[model samples]
Structure formats: C-alpha cells, structure tokens
Target: MTAHEDPDEDIPTGLDAAVTVKVAGVDQQRRHAELVKEIDDAQEAYYGRDKPFITDALYDELMLELQKLEAEYPSLRTPDSPTQRVGAPQEETDFSPLTHPSQMLSLDDVFSIDELKEWMTRTEAALGHTPEWLCEVKIDGLAIDLQYVNGRLQTAATRGDGRVGENITPNARTIKAIPQRLRPDPAQDFLALFEARGEVFVPLKEFAAYNDKLADQGKPQFANPRNAAAGSLRQKDPRVTAQRPLSSICHGLGVADGLAVTRQSDAYAVMKAWGLPISPYNKVVHSLDEVLDFITYYGQHRHDLIHQIDGIVVKVDSFAEQQQLGVTSRAPRWAIAFKYPPEEVNTRLLDIRVKVGRTGRVTPYGVMEPVQVAGSVVSSATLHNAYEVERKGVLIGDMVVLRKAGDVIPEIVGPVVEMRTGAERPFVMPTHCPSCGTKLASEKESDKDIRCPNSKSCPAQLRERLFSLAARSAFDIEALGYQGADAILRAGVLDNEAQLFNLTPEQLVTVPFYTRGATPRELKEPALVPPPGIRDGRVLSANGRRLLENLRTARHQPLWRVLVALSIRHVGPTAARALAARFGSMDAIRAAGVEELADTDGVGLIIAEAVRDWFTVDWHLEILNAWAADGVSMADEKSARPAQTLRGLTVVVTGSLQDFTRDSAKAAITDRGGKAAGSVSRHTDYVVVGENAGSKQARAEQLGVPMLDEAQFRELLEHGPTPASETPASETPAPETPAPETSAPTTRASGAPGTPPETRDRRS
Candidate 1:
C-alpha cells in the first residue's frame, strides 16, 4: 500500500506491524509503518518546531489521499486521524469565562492554485463585476476579541469553539502597540465604543527564545510558538501572560457603536487613526489578478518579515457587498483564504552575536549560512536574550533545522541532536556594551537584562535625544530629521543642544537638502543671506512680539510644559503635570529642601531625588539659566495677577453649575479675591456647591464650613466687591448678613481680626 493509505482495520500487535485495509481501487495495508512515521515526523516539525517537513501542497495532497482511503474503507478510520481535529487541545490553566459578541468560525480549505483560481472565477461570475478584494496576511495565532467603551479599553477575550471564549483582558493590556485611549481628530468624531477582533501570537523567533529560556530554567518547553502562546494566554494569572512576548493586529470588526464606516479599508484607516493597532500589511486590490499578484509578492518576501502568517485572506472591500454575499453556517461567503505553501529549509549556524539598543538592553542574534526560506535567502534570525542561548544549547557549527513559520520570519527550530559531531562551540554574552565601550551592568532586580548606565554620554543615547528633540511632538522642526541631524553632527555644526539655535541660513543651505540639486553645474550659487523680512520665523510680529516680550518679562508660565521639555529620567508628561501643579513654580520647587519636596503629594523619594539631582547638575542649571536669560517663563503667568475680590478667603466649589465648569468658577473666585481649594476642610471659608452636589457638600456641612447656593454666591461676588466706605454703618446689619443661628464661620465671624467688631457686625 501507498504511504498515504489509512491504517486502522487490523490492529497491529507490535509497533512495527502493518494493518490491512480495502480501498475502492485495491486492498492495501491499513497501518503502513512508513506512513505513520511520516505523519509523526511532519507533525513534530510543523507543530513542535514551527518548521514543516514538506510544503503545504505536498502535505495537503497526502492528507487528501489519506481521507480518500478512509472514506472508501470506513472501518479503517481511527479517532486519532488528523482530519478529525481542528487544532490541539489547550493545556490546563486558569482562565476567566467569556462569551463572544459574535460567533467565531473556521474557513473551508482550498487545496491547490487551480482550486483557488476556480473559486475566484466562480465568485466573479456571481458578483457580475470583478469585486475589489482586500488582501491581508492570515496571521497564525490565537484569535481574540477586543472591546472598548468611550474610547477606553474595556475587555478582551479569546476565541473558543466559535461561540464562547475565555476572558483575557489583563494579558491584552501589556501589548504596547494597542493604545488604551483613542486619539481624537478634528475631521472625525472618535468612536465612543467598539468591538474589534484580531489574532495574537509570538513571532516564531521570539517563541524559540522563550522556549529556550524555559529549557535553561529546567522547565518543560513547548513544542512550537503557537502552542506556547496559546498556553501562555490561558494562564489564570494575567501577570504570567504579560511576561510572555505577545502582539496583535485587528483584521475584523465584531460590533461598532456611534460610528459609520463603509469600506473595509476605511475601517482599517479609522482604527489606525483612533490609535488601535491594525496590521500594516493590508492591501486593497481592484481585481482577482491584483489579489494573486499580492499573494505572489508576499510569498516571495515573507522571510524578511517579523510575524508569522500562514496565507493571504481576501475579502470583498464594501460592507454592503459583504452583506449581500452573506455567509455560510461557518465562514463569510465574501471572504476566502488564499494560502501559500509552507517553507522549510536546512542551514548552518556560523555564530551567534549580541546587539544593544539605545536603552542599553542586550539582545542575542544568530548569524547563519544563507539559506532560502519562503522565497528569500535568510542569513540571520534573532535569538532574543542571553537566557535563550543557554536554554536552546545552540552552538556555532551546529546542523540545525530552520523554517519560515506562517510563511514569514525565519526561525531556528532545533538541533539535529543525533547528528551532533561534538565540534560545536558554546555562545556567551559580551561583557561590554556593544554600542559604547562602557562595562555592562546586569540588572539587580531582574536577571533578564544587562544595561549600560552611562546614558548622558552614550553615543546611542545622544542620537536618540537629538531625534526626540526634533520629533513632531517636540520642537517640530520639519526640515530637520534623522539624516539632517546625522549630517549636522558629522559636520561638527552641532555638538550640544545650545548650538542648534545658532545655525544661520547660510550654514543650513550648505548642509544640503539634496546633493544633485546643489551640484555646481546644475544650479548657480547665490550670495548667502537671511530670507527677506525674516530673522527667524519663530519670532512674532511687532505688536505680538511686544506682548510676548512683556509676558516673558514676568516671572512665570504654566509649569507643566517646561518640566516636560526637560526630559528628566523616568518622568513622563503626566508625572510632570502632577509635579508642576503641586509645586506651583520652578523657584519654589528648586528652593524646597529634599525632604520637603519628597513630602509633597505624589512626589516620592525617587522622583524627589531625581529633581534634586537635576538641579544639582551644572549643565542643567546653566541650560535653565540661559533659558531664563532668553526670557522663557517657567511659572504659571496667569496665577500671578493681583488678588481682586476674595483674596485670602479659601473656598471649595463643586457640582454642575450654570455657564461654568468647576475650574472656571474656581478661577473666577481667585480672580475676584478668594483662594479656591479642591477639598472641603474646616479651614475653608465657604463651600460653593451647585445643582447635583454630592458627598463634598455633605462633607462641608459635617465639617461646619459655610455653604452657599449658586445664586447667593453670584450675588455676593457681584455686590461684595465695593469699598467699605460705600456701606453706611447701621444697628440693623447689611443685606449680606449671616443668619443668627447659622453657627458656621463667615468672614465677619472673627470680629476685630481685620475690620473692627462694630464694622464687621454692621457688614454681617
């Protein structure tokens, strides 16, 4: 019998024995030893190693032949048959229960290129016109559903049995690419909430590295990346899942609310605009021919990619058309998977090397003899970290099995242990930083990494700093980018931050926007001078400049942005804002003792120390002084105006009020003469609580702070600002008098404290 025949009828008494079966064409061995070995070997390679023993075309052919043999001889079919299962069962773990918004479904298979072409022809015939197709890589990993509410991440779940799934919210949050908040745009209303579905998986190389680490730890290693990722995701403890390297790309929508999207491409664009992580490889094609072209292109270039993708998924672009086409009990009729053949190749490991990032984190990489995987020749693959090298027991000159998983990302699956010649050399991590000549310092808290502590002087750090300063979010000098910065640095025109502002237009043009455009014969050089009517575009017009200059002449500006621009260690925008609001001004913050700074709300010892260290630095102090000399304000200019009305009186404002936010009302109080404090306390002179006032108003009553309704407060604000001489002293008391039994303290409660007892009583 052929190796593809089913072997289930006659039970083999021994492992090497064959069983007999009858097919339509002939009687054959039901359990051929060679066929079983081939199946086992292929499974081990495909599932355990992420490397296929044969191409998809060959594998599918064998599977089809086996199925045909089993169909004819039903008695020969076994429960262990590969065709009987969709995927391997999950390993035991603690996972939360989840219900899918919509049912998950599997796609029907199309075996050959001929079959794919035929399916396309039939689809076109039914649709009338050649419907546009969106070609996307079919990611090989666990499918998941993500839900967002009011632009905030709410929950995430895994796909299980196409109907229900397991909740995996916490695990999903660790992915940096998936934004927690949707960024708004002026042109479109941000989606308030929506459900998006995608696949999450570790890249093949990352999976190997992960497994290698586990092996080094003397823990059981997963056979393949997909299995490992699936197992990791199902862990009851989300922290464990978070530690695993995982990434996702949204390819489909589950549910959407308060938003209208017509086309699939538009949906992708909207998702990206909202800061959702969508696949960058999606393409909208005009016809089936274009779809085929994309498939060919991806197949030919897959090895250079990072993630694992099995095939191309083509779908009708228009939502309406998709609806018209409808769906089967399983998959959508408008969509079909155009899979590529699997790629597995043999290559030799020449050496393994470690590379360092800007952050000084060391990562291991492999250098190998060039071998074709998918359609490209690959010479190297990432080994991830030091832990991976020791775990895999990989060595130089080892004969290894390599693969292009999901037709992307070349990976070294394992060594051919039986063929080891004992000539392989062990790999070790470098003792010094690769980018800089500094000694590497291993992390004290974790053995996962070693870093270079010389951040200020590191060449990599300097390059990153220059790039960050010129980024769109920072100073936004569009003409200056990576290439421009590098050229300027090479020319020694910019060695430090202060030198950037000194660059003249003459010096700038000489740096060259384009070498061809500046060639001597091509264009005549003109006498260098600053552009007419512009010394620097940053300067405002005469009147505006005068106003700005006057504002800068004052002591302060809003402190948040100034702190953010400093780029202190471990301090981001949010932390900077919090620090600025608490500290008030740069001078006040700098003058405060370290203990006092640390005692401020939200300012811990670490942050306080950082702040102190920053001020202590001579260069930092010089920069700040120079900025001050150049008329840059570092305190809140708006808060420094003369006290107008309630100056010295502390008040707390709360709840929804007419025509004003709480902040504006508080500003109004400060603008008039009062100090607006956030919380109600015994020291507060008044609590201005509006409609829908809640616990704060109750707390004010309990604390005996005087409370005011919106109208009364407005009246007091409007008429209370007059000079004391305008009021005539009387035995009867003023219109703004407090009630006799109120008991709450008012401005006039402490008679003779400021105004005389008789005058206070008259005012009251």
Candidate 2:
C-alpha cells in the first residue's frame, strides 16, 4: 500500500480492533512503530519526490494521532519520532543540502475559535498580561530562507528537516520579487549578516495561465497553486524554473546579526525599507476580539487576494514576549495558525445534467462523487452553460477538481485530464427541455445559454421561483427550502408563488409530505412529535406548521423584498431597493416608464427594462395582483425618518464593527440621510474604519478624508460631525472620542497610541 493509504488498512489484525481494542506495552509499541513507518513514508513522498498522495489535512491528522499515542505511552516516544521533525528529511537530489544557521520551525495550528481562545488564555497567563497580536495571511506556498551578507543576497534554501535544507539559490534568484541587494538606509542600523524567511509562490491568475499553457502543450497540470510553486522552484534546471512566473514575500527572519527591531511589525517595516517584499494585509491589534475580527474578515475574503492562503498566522508582536514563550521541538509556542476550512478537493464527475432555472434558463451542472470541502459535503456543482463544460474540458466519469470558497456556491474548476479513462464521455446539451418538453433555444443568437421559453407553466420554473421567494434576500420563509418547494409543487399545493402566502393548513393536510400520524415515532423520540395543532387524528409536520407561520410573517416584508420575489430578470436586491426608494409602491413602479426607472441611482438601464418587461407580462401581473389581494405587502410604509445628522455627506464604512453588520452600518448611514459609498475618494466626507479595514482606510488617509472608529461613528450618527468653526484649526473636523486609559492594554499599533505601525507577514 502507498503511504497515503489509511493506517487502519495496513493493520494486520483489521480496522476496528486497531482503534477500539486498547493496547499497552508491546502492543502500544507495535502500533507506534506502524504509525511512525507510515508517517515517515508519507513525509518522504511529500518533501523528496513532491508526490503527496495524501492531503495536507490527512497528513496533519496522522501526525496528531501519533503525538497523542506517544503522549499516553512515554516509552513509545523516540528521538526519531516524526512528531519531532519540522518537515521531511531531504533525500539524494540534484541540489546540495545546506544547514540552516537557526532551526526553521513550523507553527502549531488551532482549528477552531475556542482552541484559539484557549491558546490566548494560556499565553496571557504565561506573560501575566495579554500581548499585542500581529495577524497576517498565511500564504500557501513553498517556504524558503534567503541569506544575506553585507546587504547582498548570498544563498536560498528550502525548509528540509529544520536543521538542514536543499539549496535552490539559482531558482530563487529567478523570482523577480526577491531583491538581489538590499537598498541602503543611512540612518537605520542594518543587519550585516541575516536570513529572511519567506514563501515562494505562484499567483492565482499566473498559476491558471501557466496551467493553461501546460494543457495546450499536452503536459500534466499541477494540482494546486502550492504544489505548482513547489514544482516550479524544485526544477533541476534554473531556466525551466524561470519559465513559470514565481513571486516571493518575506514574512519573517530566521537568524540575524545586528537586528534592531523591538516588535514584529517594526521588523516588517525595516524589511520593507530594505527592498524586501512584505504583505500589505498584515495587521496589529491588542484584544482577542480584534484578532477574531481579523480572522473573520480574511476567512470571507481569502480568494480576493493575489496569492492563495490556507489560514491566518497570529503571533505576539513584541520580541520580548515571543522570547519569553519560546520554541517547541517542531513549532513556536508564541504563534498559532487559525486554519480556514479547506476550499478545494478532487472528486469523480459522475454525470452532467441540465437544470431549468426560474427564468427558464437551462444550466448544466455536474453531479460528482460526494466530497467534503469548506465544511460541507458537496455532491454537485454548477458547470453553468454547456459551453462552460466544453471550455473546462470536463467529461462524465472524469476525476474533476471542485472548489467552494467560503459560503460561495460550489463550482467545478476543471477535470483532472491526466486521470481520465477512455470510457469518459463528453457532455451533450439536451435538444428539448426535460421538464416541459419545450424546444430549447437561446434568447439571442450570441447567447450561450438555451432556455425552455415556458416560464409561465413549467413545473421546474415554478419550483425555482418558490425557492427564490423563500430565500433570505427575499421573503425569508424559513421552512421553504428547495426540497420543501419541490414537495409543494409536486403535490400541486403551490401552482406558483402567488398561492404561497394563501396556503391553508386544511389544504396542506392532504399533501402527505406535510402530514404525519398524531403520535410520535416512539415515546423516547418525543422531539419528533408535532406541535399541539392536530386535527382529525392527524398532525402537520413541524416544518409544515413552520411554513404556514413563516408565510404569514413574510407578508409584512418590505416592498423591495416583494419586488425581488416577483422574479424580474436582473432586478436583484440593489436594484429593487433603488426602485422601491424611488417609487415607494408597486403601482408607481408599474406605471413608471423604463427611462424613468433607469434614472434611479442604483437601477441601470438593463434592470429598468427588465422590470418594465416583467410588468407587461399578463401572468406576472396576475401573480402580483393575487399576492396583493392575499394581504402581501405591495408598498413600503412611510415611517418617520431619523434626523438628517449627516445630510449631504458621503460616508464609507469598511471592516467589521462591534455592534453593526456591514448592511446594518450602511443602513444607519443612509437612514440618517447620508450617502453610503463603497469606495473611498476625495469626495468621501468620512470613512468609518473598523477592525481589519483594508485599502479603503489607506485611501481615506491619502485623500485627507476624516475617519471614525465605531464609538465615534455612533457619536456621528447621534450628532453631526463637529463644525469646522468650532473645531481647533490644527485638528480635522471629526468627532473626538476619548482614548483608552493608559493602564488598559494599548489597542493601537506597537508604537504610540493613535500612530499606526507597519504590519508584519505570515507563512502557511
């Protein structure tokens, strides 16, 4: 069996016994030996041959299990335990092995927020107080240490076995991002002999382009960007390595002479001044809440960055604090990596099938072998139109690459063509709609998607509309999921969403899917019983009762949600909000000309035309009229508006706030008669900066726009900005919030309060 195979599979006595049967002494020794062999083999395959048969996650799990065993039985622990190693040992390769001046340790990982808090609590107890935390994106790339002598680059090597590594100086020099000579700083104390630790990576876009080039040349493509970077840097020929676009960013220092920085953030600034590449996303914060906010922000925006990131590495900023909590056998005690859920995995493409959406657009999606990624098991992902399938070169029965970034919809990246068998078949778009037997044709000659053109009566279209109506952005009916919508439609209970709010409890009882026996399945399973609303010895299922209740609650939703529930093409929440804010009622919107609707700030010509076209449809108007007749909201109620404290001002809110979500913050600004802008510019009156604020905060500072923290923002919302005449001539006309007490832990950067310090870098 390969090193990647499960250890239980290799166990002689079978799987269950290997786990459940507790063993001690000789048996523990045997199990320890088996784990060690398996882990060592995996390490060799991963580091030496660059053939990681198992995932990085699986490798970590195996190593963790081994550590637990050794901890329980001390005799099993050995000097050569895989847990004691930083990375795999280098085997005989073309490159010469070079020993690092200082051991290159890896980081301990915390998988959950609770675990991270535990680490912080322990750290705070150890130091007698909480230390300033430096947060940085953990770049998923190959680690390299660059040596410099007298400000000139000397050699570069990979992290082999912590103490020793393979020299790849020639390949490292090819990365243009890496500086060959440090810039001279006359006033600064420069380190004469130092080693900078950084990651060598292939940017996401460049990696895609390189993979496309390889595909055109009929060469095998790399699995992921991390692997691509490793493969590129480890090339035997430097010229071959140079062909791929490689980038580098220094996040840390390994060993140094004459270093003068007191904090990690300051060291990064020094590195930046010396012409070394450092990440712009690094941040320094005082509290655990701020750290969590930073993690949350990056977790949501990981893919938006240039390079891939597996997690966020948080370290104590102060050099003294880091020293007090020193290194372990394999990782630093001062730092821990908070890993985001895995985003990509390889799975088999079972088949490609077409789905008819609410607008009658037929979309092709791949049904794949179920694989867990991004905290969920995704069995299928959208392939979009038929052309997308062909463009991605994915075939039925091919092992394909699937990706799910955070909460975004899962999608098929492409097929693993190298693993395809001859039996794999290309997909063909259906000539007719499977739902209604209507001939499929594109609305426009140039359009890639084919539609059913039976939107009014197609079962598939009606079901999708019902599902869309219940979405959180629309009516937010809690019990009406895709399956619920399908069940109601299949049972003929909901012809369309017009009858959604009119669903009677009596009519629902006939639909067997929504009714159950009055008794619970068993006395022990009392939770399965429905609420006390039984009739005729039968009861509505919990979800059925919930659906009815939710429908009643949904009727009071705002005019914008009502508009979104109407299924107008191109009329999403933004456009709907603009239209509702402009016209106020359904009648006004229906009466408005396309030009008049298009004149609204956020509603463009396309959305305006779509809204107008939707109003003209007889069935669509009937659905709207029926819903209105059923007491569904058709107009936004005119309530007393808040005081226009920020009237005529443009404000921008970025990052997470302690008291408000992004939408809520924007709503607070707009409700008080201020224009909430997304990007900062010269016209921006104020930018409310929060924890983990990105480039917009910098842009605000560049243009001399006033900035406010959460407390200041609250003050501004209650009372207008301080008048220019009343404000001191030397200070900007912004709210003045009192600073945190000196005795309290400093919340700002490493230096003086109110003066921001430079951010640091992190490795995956």
Candidate 3:
C-alpha cells in the first residue's frame, strides 16, 4: 500500500478500489524509507568525517523534514534516525593503535548566559568551594591531540568522533608555533609522555587575505577560517599546510608521563614555554567575580584581537580537583564552556540610509530605534550589501533582528516576519552614490558590492581620507583628532583634504571647541604657532616651533604611511607596509601596470585595482604631488648594518632586560636579522629570559632548548655569532648580572626604527 493511504482502508482481497489505495500507501512508505537512508548517510559523512557536501541550512532543513516524516509515520522511524542524537558514529581508522590515558571528551553546550551561570552555581554547590576559573578564548577551529614522548614531539591527530582521530603528525609539525622537542626540566623527572589538546585556527586577517588571493587567482574560497584551516590540515602534502597560517593554542592537557604539574595553569605555562601557542588572554581568577570580569572584558574587546573567539572556556584550575570531579558520559565534569549569547536584539527598522565610504563603496545602513544589546545602546546597524538586505528580506518600518557578530559591528540579522505589518516598505539598492550623486556600478560576475564611480571629490570620502591622515599611527598629529577635524570642517574654511595646508592662525581662531558630553563652546583664543617660513602675530615657543615644523614635514612622510592614511577599504597597516616595501616610491607604484602590481607579494588583484583607481584621480595625484612639493620626506635615508649573528633565528624575550626596554629588546632581535616572536617554540634558537621569568623559562627547559639570562644574552650580542660547537650546553655557567635598580637610557637610537620624530618626541 502507498504510504499516503490509510493502512486499514482495505484488505488485499479480490481487486477492490480500497485494496489498490492500500497498495499506493505501501509504495509511499518505501519512498520515505529510502529518503531516511539517504539522510543518514549524509549525516555520517558530515559529522563523522568532517566533510560536508551540503550547506548547513540545507542539511538542517532536510533533517527537520525527516523528523516531521518520522513523527507522522511512527513505523517509519528507525534506530539510526538523524533526529534522535547529537552526532554520528565514528569512522573506522587505520592509524597505529594508541589509547588516551585520560579519555578526551566533548563539551556539553550551555546556549545562554543564564544556563552558564546555572552550571557555575551547580559546580560550586557540588565542590563546596568557589572554584577558581581559568577563562580562555573558545576558538572555533579543528581540535587536535598532540603527544610528546620524553620531551620530544611524537604524534598529532585530529579529534575524529571523540574516541579516535586521523593521524596528522607531519602537517602538525609544519605549524611553526608547535614545538618539535620539549625542554629538559631536571626538577620534573616523570614528564616522559605528555599530551596536549588544543584547537588549530587561522587568524581572521590572514584568512581574509588568503581568500582574497584565491579570488584573485580565480580559485574557490572557503566559507570561513575554521573550514579553511581544517581543509588545509587535511591535505596529503605537509608543504601545503605550511603555507597556511594555521596556529594552535593549548586549552587542556591530557596524559603526560614526565610532567608533574598539579594545576591547569602550570600545564598552560608548560605548553606555552614548549612553543605550543597558548592563548595570550588566558587568565586565572581565584574568585567568581574575577571570572565574570574576564568574560565581560573579552566580550567587549573581542574585535581588536587577531583570532576569532566565539566564547570563553572556564575550567577548574586544580588537576587533582579535576580528577575528583571526573566526567559524565559525554563531557568533563570539571569544565564548562561559557558562551556569550549571540549579540542580537529586536529593534524596529526605522529607515534605510546609504553611506559612501572612503573607497567609494556604497553601503546600506539601517536606521533603528535605540536598543540596548551586549551592554551598548545601538541605534543603527549595517545591512552589509544589497544581497544581504534581499536575503534577509529586510524592510523599512519592520521589526528586525540586529546582531553584532564577533563584536565586529552591528548588522541586521533578519526581519521578524511574524510581527510584520502592512506598513513595511521594501528597500531597493540605490543606483546613485549617496555622497557625490555619481552612478553606482556593480561588477556583473562578482558578488553584489555597489561602488561609486566618483573616485574623488566626494565629501564623505575626503573626510575619511583626512581622518586617516591624522590618525595616531600615520602623522602623530596630536591636534588633529576627529573632533578637531570636524570643527575645521564646520568652520566653512576647508572643503577638501588639501585645504588644510592653506589655513592660517586667523582661520584657526574661529574654530569651536566641543567637550565630549557638553555643548559646543567658543575657544578662548590660545596663542597659535605659525607654519614654517610663514610668520603672523602668533606667539610661539621652542616646542610650538618644533610642532609646526613637524606638521609641515608630515606632508612628505613615507609612501607606506600615506597609503595607510588614505583609509582604502580592505587595506590594513600590514598590506600598506607590503605595498611600500615593494614599490619603494609612490610615483613608481602609481605608474606600475596592473598585472605587475598584482604580482607583488601580498598584493592581490582587488587591492592592485584599488591602488590603480586611487591614483587615477587627477585631484589625488595633485594633492600627493602638492605634499611632495611642500617638502614631505617620504624616504628613510639611514639603514642599520646587518648583524649576521642572528639571521633566521627566532628569539623570545621575557621579563625586564638590563640594557633594553621590551620594545628595544625586540628591536635588538630585528636589527640582528632575527625575529622576536612573542612565544617560545622548537624553532626558537634562544630565549633571552630575565629575572622573575616564569612560564616561558619553564617551557624552554621542558623542550631541552638552551635559555639565556640577561647577562648571557648581552654576551651573545657583544661576542658576535656563537658557533654550534661553541653554543653553551643546557648546564652552561651563568654570566655577571647587572644591578636591578639601574635604569637604561631612553636614547633616540633605542626607538623603533622608522618611527616618526614627532612620536619619538612625544615618548620622551
């Protein structure tokens, strides 16, 4: 009988109409069974193998449909139904036999803040003490198990189905942060077999860059960094993995034969020292108050950090305590991941406004009634692109769900369809630039990213350009902040970025002052400093004279600084540096062919086109040339002699150095052709550890890597390169130490190379 027909409608006797209907019901049942099998297979491939062919939304929809079918037809439900469980069965593995001494388990998810708080309360009640919580960034990436045998690297495996994992030792070794060998610690005699569990992830900026490069080369891009990292690690060739910016941070420890650590913090320190990257933001809090404070702090400042963190992992500090706490069937009892709820708020979409950015990209922003979300009052949220607006079906005067994903920026998640009234108006992407009234154009083959054809003379674009020029990293112009620039703009004295040079003391005297939270007030005319080679009745001191000189000289600042100051979309400080380093001069860069520009390392087609488009505008070229003509110095004349002693070596400096500040210590490494990385690794040739050095020193010992005290580090500097044979053994003699009280001189030479004179003066 067909599945749609009632089973009791007819008996299979002598050619009756009801019997034929029942036969139709039987056919429908067979079709439903086939669909269930198909879905189950797909689920197995996705969750079990970590290789999903279908989109998450599609998979979810299919599973929901399957669930509904099973509910409707109880007899169709099977033991292996997708709706019955959280994950699929583990795939068979062929790797060498290895057993986890302490079984690694998955986390039990608590979706909301209230749930997390409840979990904490329950744990405290069970323990009979306020457990010290160590909060760490919950990185959304691939989990890997690293095993170190006798202080040496042995194996690395993917967390496949909790019980077993795919062996990825070669790929793991290519990750520069992972240690190849453990430092020898005489104090810890039992640490022979050590296992560290962590997530491997790509930083957001690097991932974006990688995707951009892929697009430029006409290759498909991954959806997100997590997927990118996973795919890269799973590649058969280790060399491919090395090219990706895959980094790992140890969040928990597993079985260790040689280690005698009693606490989670000690394990973290050991992991960090051994050169496996541990989260820099990891903190140990003795009280629940401190734990909440850390969560709040990280939640607010999440965007500023490099990597993407979805939530914080809070774990019990004591290993013995953790052992006693033990595990449930699925998750560890000692720990729980405290997830910050998705930053989404229900708000009425009042209106839609189009904004033209500095790069002339037209973005649709939603004007909303003020709503408090994640401790901030947000009045507006970004619509991202025309496609997003249409996909979300966002409409004017509609109640919409606004979200700030990763705390990056507020964006309209979707419109609330259930609450929609007939008054809601559909939004259409604009055909003209909102700022300059130029025609908006879209690249037909690419995603819908609307752009203004007016490359220059846009008021909004110019304001951003000027702001970029006056930013702290660019010109070190203390007087020209956002408010100051706005005041300048409001005075009706300046129309473009170039008009700033034409301003006089009389013009400046008319500028208004607006205190942060107060009404605007007329400034009590402070005595002004005249520009260089121009004198007015402005009272000037030595410092004032210096400031004016610096301001005039800023016009000729380095090409890289100028590029950064322009605030091009998708271009950051690192990209600007790469551009400047390659081109050497602005004129050469502007004149270069598009393909040639694209061929430059780190400069993709999009950025290359952006650079070309920026320079194509006559006014932009005129302004740059005007600055050059007005005596801005764009080149560095002095070059430091290369120190061959430290070439290609990675060094870590910890604690206070005798002859240098932290910055200077880093500079010393750079000046000597070595990289001063923040953490220790097997690749690290030396660790310049100072007095009161804690975690890093311990790690260096565990890896059997040689550590240098401040005096020994200084000796290495003075004596030139130490040969492999001449290199001190692990038990080398200590050197003469300097007095702790002696403060090092803050000389100009000690400053960071290429730092502007204005910044150096401010530091002094």
Off by over 4 Å in 1: 1-121, 124-217, 220-225, 228-335, 338-428, 433-436, 442-456, 506-525, 528-565, 588-609, 627-633, 639-764
Taken over the whole model, the C-alpha lDDT of each candidate is 0.59, 0.76, 0.63
Tell me, by TM-score, which candidate is best. Answer: 2
lDDT, candidate 1, residue 330? Answer: 86
Ranking by lDDT: 2, 3, 1
Model 2: how far residue 179 lies from native, Å: 1.9
Instruction: Report the lDDT tens digits of candidate 3 across residue range 438-549.
Output: 8888745575788876666677676666666777556656567666666667767577766665555545544543111111221233222233212232233343334344
Q: TM-score of predicted model 2?
A: 0.68
Go through the candidates in order and give the C-alpha RMSD of each one to the true structure.
23.6, 18.4, 17.6
Model 3, runs deviating above 4 Å: 1-342, 443-447, 476-478, 513-553, 567-571, 638-764
Per-residue lDDT over 1-764 for candidate 1, one digit per residue giving the tens place of the 0 to 100 score: 11112123234445323223223223444343345446545543433223355765676666677766666655444433443322121222235576776777677667466877887787777788788887777887788888777666666788877778876665665554444445565556766658888887776556767777887789756645666668777776555665677766678887776556788878877776665656646778786567666776566445423456678888889888888887899888888887666565567899988766544566787889998676578899877777767666678888776776654567776565556798988887888876678898875666677777666566655555555555433344444556756666665655555445445443443343312132343233333322321222221223223322333332233465566556565554444544655566788878877787777544578777878877887766766676566555667654654335564567677666787786568656654556667776667777776664543554555455666666656754665533331222222121221111111122221211111122111001
Q: Is candidate 1 or candidate 3 better by TM-score?
A: 3
- Poorest lDDT segment (10 consecutive residues) of candidate 3: 738-747
